[model samples]
Target: MPDMFCFQCEQTAGGTGCQGRAGVCGKKANTATLQDELTGALIGLARTAMNSTPTAETHKTVIEGLFTTITNVSFDDEAIECQIAKTEAAKQAMAPQCSSCASKCVRNDNYDMQNLWTDNEDIRSLKSLILFGIRGMAAYAYHALVLGYTDDEVNLFFYKALAAIGEELDADTLLALVMETGNVNLKCMELLDRANTETYGTPEPTKVTMNIEAGPFIVVSGHDLYDLHLLLEQTKGKGINIYTHGEMLPAHAYPALKAYPHLKGNFGTAWQNQQKEFDGLPAPVLFTTNCLMPVKQSYSDRIFTTEVVAYPEMVHIDEDKDFTPVINKALELGGYRELHPMTGINGGDTLTTGFARGTVLSVADKVIDAVKAGAIKHFFLVGGCDGARPGRNYYTDFVKQTPKDTIILTLACGKYRFNDLDLGEIGGLPRIMDMGQCNDAYSAIQVAIALAGAFECGVNELPLTLVLSWYEQKAVCILLSLLALGIKNIYLGPTLPAFVSPNILNVLVEKFGISPISTPEADLKKILG
Candidate 1:
């Protein structure tokens, strides 16, 4: 009668695995169990696909099945059950003879998560890396798939990685697979970047306001741009405004998305504050993906979910993406009677984003010149998911304490900590540049590699530091991508991942120079000095 165990995220209990009736991410025990079943079925399908050629349907099923189990993606037991059945169906299609054969072999049987959870600590750590890393990578893949972009190699690796998870592999073998997960994730992120920029024009620098204009409006949250685009199209001339929330904030920078006048400014702050911020709002909130907290009664009636994101009793918009219900709800709410002024956590009334790789690289000459002239002393990439942990303020403080001569390139929701704060400009560039969403970490890496090439050195030799704050599985895969690229000396906080064993942690520290973040003042001195 014990609870499920999950430690793939940074918010795990006591800096260890979440071992209770529910996950700290608001995932109930039943939902967690169903997620485990879905994952197990996916592993079985992978085991089957390892021998047989996988179809495009098989690849899509593997990507979605893995993405569904990521932290906060699916909360509906029914939805997860559907995923489990689909995975089993895919397995049967690939290995049709296994089920009907008189001689039954368990070679491709589903894996019980408990085995990996209770395995040798080091083995568990390594396997967790492959499992959770892919779980995060799957999100990027899902996003790309929706945009009509697919990579066969990325798809094949999902099967290879999941099959390895179910196998009784040695530590070294699993460890190698763990690194491969990182390598594969880098490619996945790149595929996503290409998909997004091609579908929507490359992101450019644009400033967003925090004020909610008077009128009916719908606030869209999550990482799905396609959902936002569909909503914008459906809501055109309907007198309903659309506001981006959380990861959707970066949509403002996309020329195609910004062309829709109804896509107004962002609303609320980071995902963690939704319960408090959404209370009694005059608008409906549509969630397209993860980072959904347990809904409170105060605003649960106004919450809607689409795609993989779900909550019991909340209205769900199916694949057809007909958002009439959401639009009607927005019209009913009618939003605030007059303009409502809003501010970021730092009390800034405006937010700036769109400093994606295209924008940054376009001004490469200015940046290189600034650095050579000592106008920019250092470059800090301070970004990741923003969680409820008290220590997360370290990001805000870290950005605040960074020298005036330094440039801060931020991405993901973590930038919400101090994004609105005007850090002034260096060489005609804002001191802190918003670099789009978490997957846009691809953009940041591109900038780093470009800079290294400009300086005629490796990325590690460049004057750049990655001070990251992680909350979910996406952050896990991003960290892996960095390590896989041989980028080192990353300052990670507010805490280390609970799934990382002591020996594994030691290996990371010694090999990658990964360090847990300290006080902003101390860490600043260490990095600057």
Candidate 2:
């Protein structure tokens, strides 16, 4: 067998998979093997949980283990191995009698991951959708878990789906579970939405600056708002400033989070540019979650990882979540010499976020009036993950070419493409509205459903067109949610998943009318027409 095989992300090597000494994401072969082993152990734990009673720790460990294997999350073999040991221990505690039995059965053994990889193509495709979709959902679940929120339905589905991956299932059964993954993920996203809004307050439209104040400051990235909130609270009176990066940008929208006087502003662009953006930076960068690129020597010492994100030689904040190392590093770095300024990819000095469902629906009457008055002709939900792919420019161009009478609702890191562009407004609202982070795709769905309700039509009949760019499994789950909701005519790009078999692609196309994005002009013309 090859040393490694990973094609979970959109940029998998040569559009097949990365099977060699290293993955395209810089994950080494040994690290990949350990991840597979960790996955196998997680399967065993979940399999054992089917026949025995498991604790809250079992669900949390399964969520963390699935999330750890996500792209750009962790590349530390030691950490992955540690996670494996923990999974084994969890399994042992759950079914100790099975291990000490005089007659051994294969009921409690870890599922060999390679078996699924080499399974029948259609079965693999359907199961991959379920597996990858849950992997993405676990991220949202993990974030909620940290905020002291738990949903039994969502947690229970984790076992069902993980166990299903290890079973001999047919296409019809697996496909149903695949769509159910989407259905359950919708609830999971809603659960997370409630957790975030209740804890941090509903996000309001907030303008975040791009300038770095002259002093000791730290740039916090990734999707974990709880970590950012804790860091913001701890650094409040210390004279150290805080700036958000990547998916953390939407933290500015939440009332409780933005109230931090020292929570200065945004620092950089999307996650893919971190290596270049953080090269030789004066301040330290703390990652609370995924999208952590390989550490570069230029600023290796400045990277501090917490939660599931880990890398070799980086200072990892443990369960205590004590950020003293990161804080002291910021003190040592002392930040910039003067007021250092930065701009977005579009050279805009400021970025606006927090146009979540609550905020947008607050103006629903005006939006409805605009549509009735023919002032807003169409709506485009252009959002998803951003990456280093060259074809991602299609999103920027597609957004730029949108007609003036249309409205664009975007979320997630993909908005960094054209968010800074002033798309103008209709009925006293900006044409382009950011609806929080990727998890906020729920907000977009809400807005669409509201519009459909206002017009007495189905969501599929609304003027909204979903043009998505996916880079990771989070996008996978979101896509499944949309498909499960029966929304159609969605456009996905820059490239489709390498794990999708030809028959499965045929199924998605025939059932949902899923389209691969072409050129911006061509796609825009087709979508408009």
Candidate 3:
């Protein structure tokens, strides 16, 4: 048996699941075991979805069921057990005609992840991409559902991809499937983009202060915009201010969300720093998605979970999405007695975001002019998940070493590493551009495509380098998206995927020009050479 601490989930401290008698949140070993069973059953359901065109309900069920097993979500064994049973029921329902068939396929037996994890490295990496990419895609799907937005193609692919992962497959086939994950993810992301823009209006360039104004307020974290919208609606006229945290930082960019008078500012950096940043906070915190680290006892009681996020003893608001309990907790906490001043890790008082393609392309003329004049020598997109691993220092050093003339466009939790550092500017533009959450990688891609068009070059030929650090599935999908664009020379780190076999890695290296991070100095030399 492994020790008690495992961070296998996005919010986990390390990459492995806590395998002790109980998880950090008091998740019993039995519960973790059952969660594994739930995951296995969901995979089976995905297999069913592959063979048949599932209903709308089936798509939503697959997304929610898989997402629930993500880290820091449901620790309730009973809830997980119910979900497992529900998944099994779904599998049976989808294959109702097969029960009486003489041809009984034993391949439907539970697909153990151990087989995937322990498989040949290349196959493992490809399968890992499919599995993790879907897991992250499920979060996006769940958020889209919250806003009454759903896509048939996006939903169906979840089944197809999940089922594929369960089947015994070879390297070349799995590699193609891995790339397809990126293609499907693009559709899934488009659905979410429509959901957010339709619901909240397209995001505009906005400035967010680091200071948490004095007043009763609620700090909202995670990547779900619908939850933020609902909380903003409920908190309207309630004198409670709302601040975005981690991946939620980008929510401040949307026109509908930014229009709220009480939607004050951002709270903290990335998920990894939450335990320290949220300690003794006077306002309640609401988690709307993944990348939630283990909650500390100090602030656990004040935390609330909506959607799939759950923890032992934490109040989980159901689908009703009513935020009254969270609001009341903030009201009771009474927030800060005075206007407390706060700054980012770099002592910058505020961080301006919402520079997605819409805003960036709107000013393409100035950007192009700067590039033509040599004011901007390069563009480095240093983004992705921020992990606790010692290897993660590459991001910090990479950003610090970026040429002074280069502009750094960043999104997701990875920006926390360098967002605070005032890297100055190229021309009149701030060198360090915070484009928003992980899903906002869509915007980064858009910007790159626009820039390439302006310069009459492909995205790969442009001076932009995507140096990413991935720790979870959302990162997986985002990387897939980059590859789908035929953008090569991507530098990925802090460590390669555990599931990626040596042969698979070699293929990536030869085909995509993918290289693991060396030292910042050496990698920078190679990239700039």
Candidate 4:
């Protein structure tokens, strides 16, 4: 028997599962168990929600618990245990009689996750899909909730899907729930889309530098734009320059965020490169959400975590949202003495982002004209979470080999693979257009729909291909959303998910025409043909 069981990520051990003392993502067995416990408690809460009316706080707790279990999010056992206790209190408040029932029915109890882990293989696989999908959706929901945006249907679905995890449902029923999870997630993503655009204004095309100006600075990583906005406000005129790291890079495209002169340019490349990039760094790095790697001693003291992204011994910014500690660390480090220039994988000094649906649709006529005139061959959405795994270079090579006439639209950190490359322009629009962060997949879908309308055809009929590289559960929900929309022929890699049993994989392949990526040349030939 193994000490832990975690195979929710693409980089799971042996391409099957992780069951040793630690996972490939550096999560220890004890911490993994605690996360499982927290998830189990959330399940109990979900079961209670089905019976009684749930408060807004109840929905937030469920989202928080699910988001905390995502890969590379929370590694602090204490934080997770605290979350578990909070979940228990919420459940008890909802069903107070269950605590003192003399019947000993064992109902309304925190489920033992081991049951799901040890269930029938096919059954377990289907349930895992629902479990992981909602876990990913929860991150998006948490972001929206923080911004004061949410959908009742989306919140209600969380409880429904979670309760299903604790039930002994048939494969057909569970599978239907899996697709429903995807469908509801689409609504969740849209809610977040509205919250972001309406709150901060629609994003516009903007260029971000890779070079670092000398002086005290702070690097904000993860996906919380509100956290970055607060830091930008608190540090206004404080002489401390701020830079976006990883998924936060898209912040530069927002008119409101871009208005901050001290926001500066991006720092480092992707989440996977943090250990090497932040080593002995003279500045503090504030993590607002996921993709937080295990801190190294060289820069652990300089790391600060806010919201649900926690690691042991790091200074965690409480709900108060006060960034005084992070700001002070930046001042203490004092940054580099001279201009420090940084280039991306392709040796380019600048990266461009903010080509969301509105921006793309604004130029729909030009895109249609180029396609009709044969100047543009096709559109490839090469996006998803980037990770520290081999074979990921496939994305870079895949993008590089694309026909000069075609356009590469990307989002999320995976763009770091070749985003720096000067792919040049076609019809005044760059060959490569970055839509936004992972959640901004909503933007990509909207662009596809508009293009389909322009061509007087279904989205499947458009000359568009989705080549996605996934790493975490957030990728799972996005893939589900794509499936729910009847989007077909998605080519996923560097490897298929371990949580996806052979049986489930077949369902995706047969129904959706989904294929695993082979190589740049081979996939290009197949897609182009």
lDDT of 2 by residue, 1-529 (tens): 3499888998899999999899899999999989989888888888898888778998889999999989999999889988998899989988988888999777678988899889988898888898899999999999999999999989989988988999988899999999999999999999999999999999999999999999999999999999999999889899999999999999999999988999989998999998899999999999988999999999998999999899998989999988999999999999998999998888887899999999999999999999999999999999999999888989999999999999999999999998888878897899989998999999999989999999999998988899999999999999999999999999999998989999999999999999999998888889777
Model 4 lDDT, residue 430, Cα: 100
Residue-level lDDT of model 4, residues 277-368, one tens digit each, is: 99999999999999899899999899999999999999999999999999999998999999999999889999999999889998899999
**Cα RMSD to native, each candidate?**
0.9, 1.0, 2.7, 1.0
lDDT of every predicted structure (CA atoms): 0.92, 0.92, 0.80, 0.93
Q: Among these predicted structures, which one has the highest lDDT?
A: 4
Prediction 2 global C-alpha lDDT: 0.92
Q: Residues 384-469, candidate 3, lDDT per residue (tens digit)?
A: 98876677877888898888999999999888887778778776788888887788788788888888888999888898888999
Please identify which of the two predictions, 1 or 4, would achieve the higher lDDT against the true structure: 4
Clashes of each: 0, 0, 7, 0
* Of candidates 4 and 3, the better by TM-score: 4
Tell me the TM-score of each prediction against the true structure: 0.99, 0.99, 0.92, 0.99
Q: Write the per-residue lDDT of candidate 1 for residues 1-529, one digit (tens) a residue.
A: 3578888888888888777798888888888888888888888888888888899999999988888988888889898998898889888988889999888778678988888888999999998888889999999999999999999989999999998988888988887788888999999999999999999999989989989999999999999999999999999999999999999999999999999988889998999999889999999999999999999998888999998888889999999999989989999989999999999998998999999999999999999999999999999999999999878888988899899999999999999999989989997999999999999999999999999999999999999999999988999999989998999999998989989999999989999999999899998889888
Decoy 2 TM-score against native: 0.99
- Candidate 3 runs further than 4 Å off: 1-31, 96-110, 118-121
Model 1 bad stretches (over 4 Å): none
Q: In angstroms, how far off is 139's CA in candidate 1?
A: 0.5
